[model samples]
Target: MFGWLRRKFGKTDRFARLDATQFPRFAPGTVWLVGAGPGAPGLISLLGYYGLGEADTIVYDALVGPDLLAMANPRAEMIYAGKRGGKPSPKQADITLTLIEHARAGKKVLRLKGGDPMMFGRGGEEALALARESIGFRIVPGITAGVGGLAYAGIPVTHRDTNHAVIFLTGHDEKGGVPQAVDWPAVSTAAPVIVMYMAIKHLGSIAEKLVAAGRSPEDRLAVVSNATLPSQSVVETTLADASTLAARTDIPTPAIVVVGPVSRYRQTLDWYTGGENALG
Candidate 1:
């Protein structure tokens, strides 16, 4: 009846707006908070795929891979919201405001973040800001570094003998420094395995804190640089030697530090057995 009504009203199609009603409409006033997953593009969730297709504007970060962006509609607007520590980058508030502005302008906004938006990705802040403005939003979760990166390295976070539990911590805090809020003593004592993100520069302080917390000086540690990338590198060290090991190595930023018994598994589990040709 509605189709006939529309056609009788001189519309070319039976239901001109059927597409919007049938498909998950990227409503003009809503923002889709999407996770791009860890470096691998195939790891993105189905909702992420849909959001990319439906979005009119996509605001992405540095960690997001280009493959995921390629899935966005050709006509979709793309914006870079990368925030590198110690580098000139866009403010968090500004990024949040951009989403609001795009949605207010009747654009379907996609706020794409790297890894799981809730896991150290700061998606909560953006969601809160959207809520304050009465903007409708959706969250699409993605695989986080704690699991995805470790898988690429062929290291299982939980092994029957090695570890029953794993703890993930950010090396950088709100100010992008080694987070002082973490109780190193408690973490070192309780967690069987520790994955530290953005803590390369502060390895010295972190190692010292771990040692002070009664962790063995020779406790195994592995720093996996550029995890899951072609240029990835892994260096095996110990709690006491972590600072020196990292300082001597040419590993770059965006590395993951695995500490505890699990770190020892990388010695044999590291399938990327190629020699250090680039570092040479």
Candidate 2:
């Protein structure tokens, strides 16, 4: 409703009203593991925005978009430690060491990641390493795509009529293959809604396993690609067609997969169309 106020005042004028003293100072010689949120630059938390303005170094990932990085302090060093399909991602140990090196040098370090830093982003591992080295750090949470992205697609992750519970899992393990540890049988029945991150590569196998383990082949599934971005798109399919869909479609990376009746909401609840708010 205040879109006009935002348009009139703009974010710059609005930002002037923030009470900086209320926030913990981003001191030099410390690191902050900040989640960049799903995809939208504006989704970054206020604390995250504070860190971006104060940090001396931004250790960002592939999912950290250029627009988001533009918010950082002009003098902040930008370090790319992202995993590309064909190129080698810097070693975890190396990334940890880098954070430590910069922190020890008395720099305010921002280990910026896509989505919640703690959720599958390996922020815990880096935190552990930092702890061992006595490096002070903080965790700044952001919205994960599984929830925010699904909402953008008009799919509520939960609904009283459909599911009392939901499940979240990765499609691949440390070795970048289908996780061998998931007990498909148990997973198939554990929740009415299943959300998979980084699962597109092995989605065919995952869909097959779920179907074989008692989940219906006809269950609704939504493949949300580049979720929350202007280019975001959702492919409504079923477990039976998941494999074929995975093989035939060139869905973008950084996608989230949803299974169960929650996807049925997309037909009516979809409020984002061609990057515009459908409710408008």
Candidate 3:
């Protein structure tokens, strides 16, 4: 009987980082890392909704949906921590420190981020910082860009016949340029559906690496900008033509690139092409 108990309880420490009891109760002193989903307010999960309502202060990014912010308690204080590549913004360390300070004050702090907090949202850094300070916090997952944004553009990451696996990768590194650590050949051969974030600026070099890695130039590719938002736009092309098409257009950051046979689904499944909606 003791052996059985040891097996069950010994594994508990593996997930101790996310223990709910370690975190303060939802009364008035707690911190929640809430994902606002990818651009759309309706895409936010119920857990995100609950965190917003209980927030005493909300530190939000620029990408967060405005409609979602409206859901926050009327008395909640809002702080802007939006960071854009090549633009001036608050330092990440500063943001993390602020979260710690807010939580230490015994306030219900909500660090609202766009897309899933753990997916390229830098939530891990904040969580680590919080843990080091011995501050209790909770992480609430939301729809990430690779999943939610592609859906809004009528592109599925995987299709039963086309692909059984998908891979989400960032185009840029901490310095905001193409990442050199990525093994192009391995990724090219392994992942049928490849979605990139912040890679619009380096699309030319990225395409070259994939091509050298044996990814066909004719492979279907789609770039969805401002995904899931009213101002969303999509540029459809092949891997070889993607860089050229992007250069000629104004598609900016907050974009997602999908490459694979699954991209062909956009032709028929795209509901945003009717021009009746805000997406161009």
C-alpha lDDT (0 to 100) for residue 269 of candidate 1:
65
Q: How far in Å is the alpha carbon of 233 misplaced in model 1? A: 1.8
lDDT of 3 by residue, 1-280 (tens): 1222225346645434433433335645567998999988888886677677668999999898678887777678999999988789999989998898888888889999999999989999998888888888899998999998988888888889899888888988888878988988999989788999888888878988999999999998888999988788888889999779768757766789888898777767777654334244
Residue-level lDDT of model 1, residues 171-222, one tens digit each, is: 8789777798998899988877888888888887898998999889988888
Q: Which candidate do you rate higher for lDDT, 1 or 2?
A: 2
> Across residues 149-168, which tens digit of lDDT does each residue of candidate 2 receive?
99999999999999999999
lDDT of each: 0.81, 0.88, 0.82
**Which portions of model 2 show Cα errors greater than 4 Å?**
1-12, 19-21, 274-280
Worst 10 residues of 2 by lDDT: 1-10
- Identify the superior model by TM-score, candidate 1 or candidate 3: 3
Per-prediction RMSD in angstroms?
7.8, 3.9, 10.1
Those runs of model 1 whose alpha carbons end farther than 4 Å from true positions after fitting are: 1-25, 271-280
